[model samples]
Target chain A: MRLFDFFKLSRRGPTSADTAKQRLQVLVALDRKGGGGPDFLPLMQKELLEVIRKYVEIEEERVNVDFQAGTGFSTLEVNIELPSETAKMAV
Target chain B: MRLFDFFKLSRRGPTSADTAKQRLQVLVALDRKGGGGPDFLPLMQKELLEVIRKYVEIEEERVNVDFQAGTGFSTLEVNIELPSETAKMAV
Candidate 1:
């Protein structure tokens, strides 16, 4: 094997950038499939809340679902804040 | 607490949709900051490849850095295919 190839083979695993890239691919693919915004966002959010409710306490404002459309593509962005560990213990 | 509030307090955790939303938010934020296409994409790719090369045997074709600009927003998509476990073992 070439010297550089050997070095490459001995290297560690994926980096944060790799993880980010993989994630972006999935998100972009989903965005493409959904096209602008998924009509089921509210229903999806309701169901999502129900599922999350099983674990930690979160405020409604802590969860957000939004769609951003550019020229040729649109993205669906969701943000949910989890309760802190201390907050969880109090519950 | 109200009946529903009590129930909401006893939830589980974020769902896949929740995760997607969080990830999308970051990606979108990055996209927005980059503004359509980052002029440094080529340089960024070169540096990214160098870093990734330290870990795996990946071809140039396997690493794709693309910008898709829509009407209002743009997305920078990066795709990298690492050497398969079997392929790595063979090396």
Candidate 2:
């Protein structure tokens, strides 16, 4: 290693920027490899519907759970549509 | 410039890793400065409640919109509780 390279390493193991870079690298790699944002969504949606059914009567089709990645934030949205009086009393 | 440095620079303006690094740097920098997320959440929540209320009867207090950060993916969670029949028809 050159003197500058040696000095830079000697200063510290890794700066915050380096740590952040490594994390981002891992995230990008995982995303590209078809990873992340899985293994829990469908399960979560099922459980959520079960819980909502306790207090209100709604069909599985009325519940939606979505996970999406934003600029710097990821979003998990749960939208549950309660049945209207007529809809609930239909059957 | 050193021969190795000159060669690396002449190779390309920025590799994918470099671009990833720069993007990660910006994200971290914005996070440290308390600038990563904001400016659209409250508005979104308000609009969401308004839309939901049009079809169903739901109050704003029962809606929760949360923003959080995690290992590599941040999360924005929205949970809304629809009013049960008894509650809606109470008054």
Candidate 3:
């Protein structure tokens, strides 16, 4: 199923998943830029913060980025908590 | 928008993105495991592959995992083609 389908099937509804998914989509598109390097987590972290700052005011300490390698696949996770008041507007 | 909301607002249907979103969501959850680390791209890549392998067959070369840091946010993208045919069924 596509993310939309999952949303339709979801008991929680798509509106709820939108923010997270939007963030994820943007994140994934950027991560695909790596070209045969050790890993771009550090670079990604730096650049990601730069991008977010351009669009939104944020707290530097709250942003995070990482890669997790699994047996069949690997995952990258980026966590960000904008200023509480800002997050509410985003919500 | 949440993932589900994006699906509804999407120009293309979520069914197509479902495979990608499902993959990304799984990847993100896994990536959240890192704690005070240099970067877990390698470990995330390994563990992700292992998890995918347990459920489905895949081409090792096709699987990708990385972190992309932006100004305010960062993202991880994992791309995997599950043996072509398997990807179809998942669809």
Candidate 4:
């Protein structure tokens, strides 16, 4: 049934689902980051830091929000390096 | 030289430049959210709230970090709703 149709689609190499998934992802990313639109990553990072800093004292370098592309995949990594409790108390 | 070469590339349809940009974007987005890898948005949102709560009191629903797919473009939106200073003081 559906499984058979999917298997038939895969004989061409990648399954239809995988290929479709791959194609859709690549198209969307390029348009947003380029396509004459403003890059939102830097903007987002700045605002995020502002909110976090209201309570926590953190160095700018300790906050990282990044989008990394690998092969056919991409990952969004959000990291915050929090200072020790003693450091927070001292401040 | 380059301009003429670019013009030649465009007459066929979308310029190579536009096509490459489009293709790259679509592929990257699909892969990140799918590809059997866990989505990062929910995880990031949860952790983000934990850090923010240390200083300001906020309801869990007030913070949002989301990835949205639209047409050929995708957006990453991070929003945090902060209460008034008076509200913070009351807390």
The estimated TM-scores of all candidates read 0.27, 0.24, 0.31, 0.26
Sorted into a CAPRI-style docking class, model 1 comes out as incorrect
lDDT of 3 at A64: 60
Error of 2 at B35 (Å): 11
Count: clashes, candidate 4? 14
Question: Which lDDT values do the candidates have, in the order given?
Answer: 0.33, 0.30, 0.37, 0.33
lDDT of 3 by residue, B8-68 (tens): 3432343553334323223232111112223223334444445445444556666665555
Cα deviation at A73, candidate 2, in Å, is: 27
List, residue by residue over A1-91, the lDDT tens digit for candidate 3: 2332332332233354333332222223111112222322333444444544543446656666655543333334455544322321121
Worst 10 residues of 1 chain B by lDDT: B22-31
Error of 4 at A74 (Å): 7.8
The superposed Cα distance between candidate 3 and the true structure at residue A85, in angstroms, equals: 24
User: Ten consecutive residues with minimal summed lDDT in candidate 2 chain B?
Assistant: B22-31
A1-91: candidate 1 lDDT, tens digit per residue: 1212222332347665433221111122111222233222223334434433443355676656654444323333444443323122111
Best by TM-score: 3
Candidate 4 lDDT over A3-28, as tens digits, reads: 12222332335554444332211111
Worst 10 residues of 4 chain B by lDDT: B22-31
Docking tier of model 3: it is incorrect
